[model samples]
Target: MKIQNAIEAKLSEAFDVRILQVENESHKHGVPPNSETHFKVTLVSPDFEGQMKVRRHQSIYKVLAEELAGEVHALAMHLYTPAEWDAKGQAAPESPNCMGGSKKDPAMNAQGDH
Candidate 1:
């Protein structure tokens, strides 16, 4: 099974999710082509209600421990409760590309010349 599908299955089993989108963002990173090491996830569930941001992230990390340790190198998560998602008009922001490391252009560097 694809990593995204696996993650979705796990989340669905663990939470009463109203919305879930698992995006394979490895292509936008500075990794080898077709790498599945990076992902962006937007999840809306009552399980997240009243939870702090760190707590929400921790919950997801705990659920995805194996994937984080093995297949996934990085994950950008946008987690919200159903009410929170409704208040925000149900629009999840897009994750920007990972522009760190030698892949970033020198001109965009804040420290000026390396």
Candidate 2:
């Protein structure tokens, strides 16, 4: 299964999911074309009602342990209970642009003049 679909399915099976969005953010990062190294996930579920944020994140990480250890380079998660989702107007924050090795450092840009 595609990584995004796999995440959705797993979370659905694991919880009473109200909303789930798995975004492949590889293109925003500096990975090769068609890479699935980075991701953003937003999950809303009743299972998260009494859980702490850390606990919620742990659950997801546990479910995706294999992918985390191997294929996935970064996993950005925004987990919420149904009420929290509603409070936030049902929107997850967008992922930031890549600033890893592939992104040029402004300080280093003047190197060519030296």
Candidate 3:
């Protein structure tokens, strides 16, 4: 939770945060147990009001540069203005299941071996 805590603190200090959720989703991926490599952040802030979607993402990336450059492998961000959150019923989209790093049986890849 160390990384998650740092992200929450930094974002709160950088923006007028109305709503924020930081979820550690590394377990959902093919990493070791209790890993902190993946995260999903949902943030609603007035600071995003005039910003474009790319800009909002950029701001977050900039704020969490250290984390991104290090242990953090993936960041799924759902950023919105207060009005946009309200319009969307104040919910972020779900993260998709992880599809990488899983091992498969060699027989499964045998082609035309029947």
Ranking by TM-score: 3, 2, 1
Candidate 3, 1-114: lDDT as tens digits:
899999999999998999999999987766677888899999999999889999999999999999999989899999999999999998999998875535243353243111
The C-alpha TM-scores of every prediction are 0.86, 0.87, 0.88
Q: Mind giving the per-residue lDDT tens digits that candidate 2 earns over 1-114?
A: 377777777878887888988889988865666887788989999999889999999999999888889878899999999999999999999887877655675554334110
Off by over 4 Å in 2: 105-114
lDDT of each: 0.84, 0.83, 0.87
lDDT of 1 by residue, 2-82 (tens): 888888889888889899989898877666667778888999999887899999999999999989999798889999998
- Model 3 accuracy (lDDT, Cα): 0.87
TM-score of 3: 0.88
Best by lDDT: 3
Query: In candidate 2, what residue range of length 10 has the lowest lDDT sum?
Result: 105-114
Residue-pair clashes per prediction, in order, are: 0, 0, 0
User: lDDT at 29 for candidate 3?
Assistant: 67
- Count backbone clashes in candidate 1: 0
| Predicted structure 2: lDDT | 0.83
